[model samples]
Target: MSELLAIAGLDCSYGEVQVLHGIGLALAKGEVLCLLGRNGAGKTTTLKAIMGLIPATAGSIRLNGRELTGLPAHEVPKAGVAYVPQGRRLFAEMTVAENIEIGLMARGKGKATRDMVLGLFPRLAERLNQRSGTLSGGEQQMLAMARALCLEPEVLLLDEPTEGLMPSMIEKIRETVSKLRGLGVSTILVEQRVEAVLAVADRVAFIENGRNRETMTAAALRADPAAVKRYVGVG
Candidate 1:
């Protein structure tokens, strides 16, 4: 339960427009932390700032006590942080195998990494040569996560992972996340599906108006439905 990643007094902006204010949270080893909020509540911004996709004007991002703030986006992954963005940003023209290979090559890994991911997602194994653009929505999502996993990251940042998926697909993604947790991969999930995230998260943090409003155990949030409704604006 030692801290794997920590954010404190974080602030970021897109040019003159500030989006995050004094945002802070921490993730323990092998734990899943769900970030909940309404649209434009700075949920995605928080993830991006952690990954150095957006520069932080102030504050600290640390992994195992190493400073990560101000690191370039590419360097962030090298620091053991992998990001699966909101949209499944797979290369449309590339095959499933090709897409997975990109991540492996970036990390100086070879077929062993590819075999590992294919083992986690057997469906992808069957369509290695299939064009990513031709795959269904669920398949695309699976590929995005698989690609990130190929990097063998210490911390995974997922943005709206369940968005636009069917019930069965959502369940599959949920099971995959649970499996990852069991394997001791620490994760920060930014999600709108309250119940889905709550089911997988060890803890939950509510963000509002570009700041962290509250953080509590998932069990606590589930026990207090009123708090969930008040902070998340959803029950």
Candidate 2:
């Protein structure tokens, strides 16, 4: 359970307005860590900062002990970090295969990479030539995840991936996260659903008002609903 990604005393801002203040969390190799907080708690900001989409004003972000604070956004994926942001940003005009190819380009990957990615998401396999915009919401999410997985990333940052999906689709995402963990892909998930997040997370970090409130094992959080109420007023 070595630390694969670490954030210490992290801070971020939007123009002159600060959003994150000394937020800290860590993810172990092959673990699923979920971030839980009320809206505007800077959970998404933490993920973006780690991806270098929004630069960290101060503090440390490291992957396998290599500093990532100053790295360019494009280089972040090359450093083995792939991000699936809140929106499923897809090229509406592109086909399913084309969308995945964009991710392959990140690592100079070829057909073998495509095959493996398709293997993980067989539904996508059936719609390779279909335009991404025409797919269902669940299908779009699969494509977004497939695109990120094409990078063969060690750390996957997922922002509210299950939002607005049906229960069955939600289960599909949960299963995919579990499957990825078995493959040694550590995930930092930003999710608000208490039951769903608890089901997949190895650990959970509570972020309140742009700072770390506490972090505990998922089992501990499940057994103690009061902690959720204290921080987010939800179970």
Candidate whose lDDT is highest: 2
Across residues 1-235, which tens digit of lDDT does each residue of candidate 1 receive? Answer: 5788989999999999999999989999889999988899999999899889899999999999999998888999888999999987999899999999998977887787788889989999999999999999999999999999988999999999999999999999999989998888999999888889778999999999899988889899878867778877766
Model 1 earns a TM-score of 0.98
Clashes of 1: 0
Question: Candidate 2 at residue 69, lDDT?
Answer: 97
Candidate 1 weakest ten by summed lDDT? 226-235
Sequence-dependent TM-score of model 2: 0.98
Error of 1 at 147 (Å): 0.5
Steric clash pairs (candidate 1): none
> Model 2, range 116-187, lDDT digits (tens) per residue?
889989999999999999999999999999999999999999999999999999999999999999999999
For all candidates, the clash counts are: 0, 0
